[model samples]
Target chain A: MGSMARAKVVALSMVDKHPEPQPLLAVKLSPAENPTAEAGADAAAPINSSALPAPEPEVVPTVSLTKVFRNLLAQITRERITTAALACVSIGALFLFWYIGTKYRVEFYIRFKNVPTPYEVFQQLTQVGLSNKYLVNIAISVRRILLGFFIAMAIGVPLGLAIGKYQRVRDLFMPVVEILRPIPAIAWVPMSIMLWPNNEASIVFITFIGAFFPILLNTIHGVHSLDGVLIRAAKCLGASEFRLFLNVILPGSLPHIFTGLAVGMGVAWVSLIAAEMISGQFGVGYFTWEAYSLVDYPAIVLGMITIGFLGLACSGIIRMVGSLLMPWLAFAPGGKR
Target chain B: MIMATAMAETQKGLIDVRDMGVTFGANDNKIIAVDNVSLNVQPGEFVSLIGPSGCGKSTLLSIVAGFVKPTSGDAKLDGNAITKPGSDRGVVFQQYSLFPWLSVRKNVEFGLKMAGLEQSKRNTTARALLDLAELLSFENHYPDQLSGGMKQRIGIVRALATSPQVLLMDEPFGALDTQTRVVMQEILTNIWQQFKISVLFITHDIEESIFLSDRIYVMTARPGRIKAEIKVPLPRPRRAEMTDTPEFMNLVQELKGLIREESLAAMAPEIKDRGLSGFGMKVGPKGVGDIF
Candidate 1:
């Protein structure tokens, strides 16, 4: 029959051994019949009849969309639902404000003439006609972001672990990291161009700079918070310092480091866009800048949306990875993983 | 494999501590957590350190484990100065000390894996240990999923897995429920008989000390020092029903009396320092979660 009916069938079979009265099921299963009180009470008598185990309902464990959807909905906790609703409301408000503010002149008391209407943007999106150009741009941008993010991780993770665990290493590098952290990624473009032989390398360098500090600092914080007792436990169990860091310190600090990576990925996107806007070709950021130069407001908005989507996806993937690595955390209360 | 190897290494009086003392923190904040806590454990002996909270019993155990260095005098393991934590000494803390990331089997296999054992051998050894301890079914389970008693029992198995020269337990059973604690004690006594490793078990429970220990070292409260060294004269293959025996009850009473006096002695200095709280056994409105 229908998916909902199938789901009910499955639910009923699971508790069929102690099946509750199925008045609702009866009404759904046989709509032609007008049920009387005598019939309903007579139907309830069979529930106890099944307790003696003459024959049970056919066990159908068939997978259905309704079952999957219901289970997923059930797993979406109150806190998660609240959070999702808040985010939807916030983004929806932004969209509504954008659409209404640019509806026409004198909209919302005052409005910028340069801002495009929501439908105008959506209309331009369908008529772009150059899907390959968009794909090529997005692909190159993603590649650059990935390259820079990985490079940042390669340097940042080991450095962070070392600096976190050893006071001497921290003292040696903390001043340098602190000094470098505050300087914006855009400011590095000029230096990067001078330091590198190619525009792509310089752009990637800027992105790397943007992603590096967040990853390093968060990893360090994670390592710093490593429970001293776990270390002792590891030590007493015959682990050398190197082995201790690998077995305990690295894994112990993973949750914090994953947080860093998520934040770093977002920063990587931001810095890559900035870098591309300044001096590069073939990226969503460059496309936005080109649209600006050509006064394509819709295209610029499209670029913004693409970048936001990519950043969100990257962070979402990081969170998924974190949950996979730390399965225990997923089942814990208030565990976002 | 477990019994024969353990018996071969059962040399009496393996751990020696002479006037072992430990003070914590820097100049102004420094507190003598342990003072002249002298005790020793014969090889295969189940020695228990019993005292009230804040009595530095854990500190004494740490000194032997080589996690904490003694401030004065010395503690030796098999005649060597216990300077640094090594594979030879396995330690089990109270609850929540198991590595949450590792599976129960992996936690037990941790030391063996660290010692560079082959993966197959480590698994075999770990599984064998789990089987003996009645925890084989829980090999894949996480520590967070297990009950307090199960966790501590597995914690004991993890410590014992490496077959250390000595097993230093710091209030390992203090977190279990009363019933689970008794079951765990029986399991531990049985395992100790089989493993035949020297144990320096720390506990705040008086009857637990009397039941599980060959010798119970009762320490005074904070700035803890050994106040009494009572030898348990009870016979081996101890049963839970033995607690009802007159001898067991008498030993329990004797330890309780000794611990109470030490608690008073521990409270005496604090009473004078506070000045207004001059007390004859006044219970404080506080909880101790730190080293005791």
Candidate 2:
């Protein structure tokens, strides 16, 4: 009896996980009246009937389960299949355009004569994808991006929080931020090289510069955009200043902070590649620039594709981490911002 | 009963406001939000402030919650002058101010956790409060997953979880549907009865104020000042049926009359300046009435 009750409890709890529509399990198990008794009987009967291989009642829940599965499959396919197909079509069209342009050696304002054909780029991809040197270059560039991005986040978030929360901090820092924010990452290449001790440090510095302002600005906007009522609610609930910041301000600003991080990841990749191209011996950016100097146009195209893929992956990881960090955002209408 | 008695050891939750006024901006931009609004709530009483839109009822509630400092006059909670927001007062806002990041249970436990309660105790307290709100089953649900009514109920439960001496509510049910608002009123009254905490509720709803409050204070238009204070003679454990009674209806009418006057007064300047007075004038040839 205890085991039957336990199974019943488990079944009921599982019902909660079902999406908005009522689970078929409930209807299959019992009539509208005396739900508990009928549900309990059905719950215990399922186990007993399974052991005895009884076909009559067992068929009901099995059919219901299949229906539920079919419903879920339909829902997933309905929303995702169209989107996926459109994305495929879009990418295919882009590739087709590229193939035509390079194959015909089309020249308008920009010349496609020197550009690698799609097949040549694919050949380069196969060669590069197999090479140890290509892997090393990718690894070097990724390390630079991660290091620079993390450092930017470490400084930008706290500073942005302080600036957003306090007038004095905002006044003290905003002028400096505004003045420095306009300087482009490529323009910082010369200054960064002179400022840092080594080529690696210089490249990372340029990446950090590329990533920092967006993060700082977004974090500030997040703090400013926080609903004032939540802060008041926190204070009223006995939160001290530090507790308020940790519990309210920090979490409140997180969505924007994640937005910053995602944007920063992309910018970091851009700056890292640019800096590497300008002053590095062993990175994807350097690989691309070297390919250009060597007139290996296909390798250059391959490098560009690799950089694009890595940047997308980095930003994708950031977004996944953000969604994980803020599980409630999933429940937000129209999906996560 | 013993727990209630122990919790009531101190003479807490007494809210006293004296000639409170709040003015914003400076020079040409100066706008007075509230003016000479004085009222008091006994330790366990449910009092409401009802006024026209922009009548500064929310501002008055904010002053008591210690979110806004009044330009003049004194506000105190249990004899301690209100300086800044503290744990002694719990506040519920109209906008369903549940932290979007936290689940229902976590939102309730926030205050207990802030007071440095251990995990087990906080969970127990939060669960107990969620049970009171009939939301224990939804403890794991986020705010957005809930309806507007459920979210506001969770907001109330979260405020109550702290076991504050006083609850300050600013139009907490304003956003709910009429049916949901009535249901919420019943729930709120039940919660208030169980907790026996002082309440200063701000609303523009006449029936709501009369239904839930022991006393209702009506305020005038902008630069809100206390227009009148009326005591509700309705019996305790207020039910929806009471809203149909003569006494309740009379009180509602009186409050309505008082507020309607203020509302018109509030709208007078806007109507004149914005040329909205034409709304009351005879219809032109293009009027919807002519088409009909």
Candidate 3:
């Protein structure tokens, strides 16, 4: 009994003497003082550690499920309300213009074959999409864009890589490239017709001219921008010259290459429309010119809509591919947004 | 002790460099980076080069790695002249030169692939090295995710993957915090003993040089030349506790004296005019000259 008492006294004295972490030591002594009396206070110490302010708490009330749902709903409602208002304003303005044309400016529509009204243009948009004439023009324009874009890619990518990797090659080619780059794609029409016997080849050459420069320039820029440190690190790792170029240089330049492709596709679409207008017999631009000559107002409107839709579709495809090819470049300027 | 000396004699010179000099630029602006200097490294020995900034310790290691060619003299490894970088010599740079794009496994497998090892063998070798570095679980992690010390360990493992005869380190732990650096030093010492590879380490830390090296070479500043080479008699498989001993302090003082003399010599002008005693740098306040 005496030894037990002495042991308890010694324990209490040690706890009192060493007070470096005073609150913590006191909490421990409290629990020893009463078996179950200070259990609640002992548990409070662990709670104090956790109660310290976290920079970003995990389950913040502001970011809870209910609040997030409410915010999402609010945003969707706001967007819908704005879109509806825009639609109303646009329709009202369009109607007022149509009324004015009907009342005063009749020559605009009357000059066309059979004198169609503004409503006729909308009707033609819905009806002409299913017609064989419209389908053929759309197919022809698409074929021209694809042939030109792919050919430019096939020639430009390898040439750009060579120019980027070798200073001598860049020196030899840069002058010729610069001299030709300033000449517009439409200017190539006259020379292409003389060089290639067929209209298809002429149109393809024009499209290629439009697409090539942007792709090639972007590719060269991409390769030039690769981090020199990455190359040196590869060399230190015993990577052979061939492996270094293939594995490091190529992948490092991919994000830039994708940028070029996106820009090239946009250029190719614009070139296709211009090339078709000049030399095409069966495309959206050619059909629009034919409608103008025959004074078919609704047909002209249909052709314009077709060209706009085609450009939108092709550009969308480019963006989709860019997203797939270089996911890390989503944050890049002029990306998806 | 006698038996150890006899063993060392058998492997008298693992690295023999003679009259090596590295000069940069041409004509009037030419600067001699490393003057005519020669040293030998024995097998399984740890040697360190210590000096102030711009002492050319890194340049000497680069020459040994065959990354740079000396303007004069030769650097031979096991009696063969070095012409290019090979798997025989592995260098750990001051920066954690881990390839960020690759996972830890792929980074470690880089040297094996360069050696033309088969896929199965490469996999096995990479796994073994990762395990040895205590980074087996981080095999799939990229370099950015790992801490600085972990990245350094990966750098060491990458070097070791080639099974090099000589290991070259240019201040491998110079970038770490003090506590972490000590831990890494202990880990490196353990690895060195296990592999028994001759290490040529460069550093500016005097205590580190004394603690880790079997012999420490102190170099003079600017146009660098070896000023002193002191052999550490402290017993090895060195532990952290040995740092507090009297022998360690005595060696630190000796190294300090040698470095102080070399620094004074480096700052002394080429032309001496005893008559103009109170001229140049020493005039005015304690640090008024701004000379480094």
lDDT tens digits by residue: candidate 1, A33-61 = 21222343333433444333222122222
Query: Clash pairs of candidate 2?
Result: none
- lDDT, residue A183, model 1: 97
Candidate 3 clashes between residue pairs 3 or more apart in a chain or in different chains: none
lDDT per residue, candidate 3, A162-227, as tens digits? Answer: 788889999999999999999988888888889998998888888898999988988899789987
- TM of chain B, each: 0.87, 0.90, 0.88
Model 2 per-residue lDDT tens digits across residues A1-337: 4545566565555554653324344443332122344554654564444343323453346446755776888778666889989999999999999999998889998899899999999888887788999999999998888889999999999999999999999999999999999998989999887988999999989999999999999999999999998988898998998998899999999999999999888888888888898888799999999999999999998999999899889988998999889999888888754
| 1 against 3, candidate with superior TM-score | 1
lDDT of 1 at A214: 95
Cα lDDT, all candidates:
0.81, 0.86, 0.78
Judging by lDDT against the true structure, name the best candidate: 2
CA lDDT, candidate 2, residue A134: 93
For each candidate, the DockQ is 0.48, 0.66, 0.13
Clashes of each: 2, 0, 0
DockQ of 3: 0.13
Clash pairs detected, candidate 1: B13-B42, B56-B292
| lDDT of candidate 3 over B44-82, digit per residue (tens) | 889999987787889998888778899999999888898
**Candidates by DockQ, descending order:** 2, 1, 3
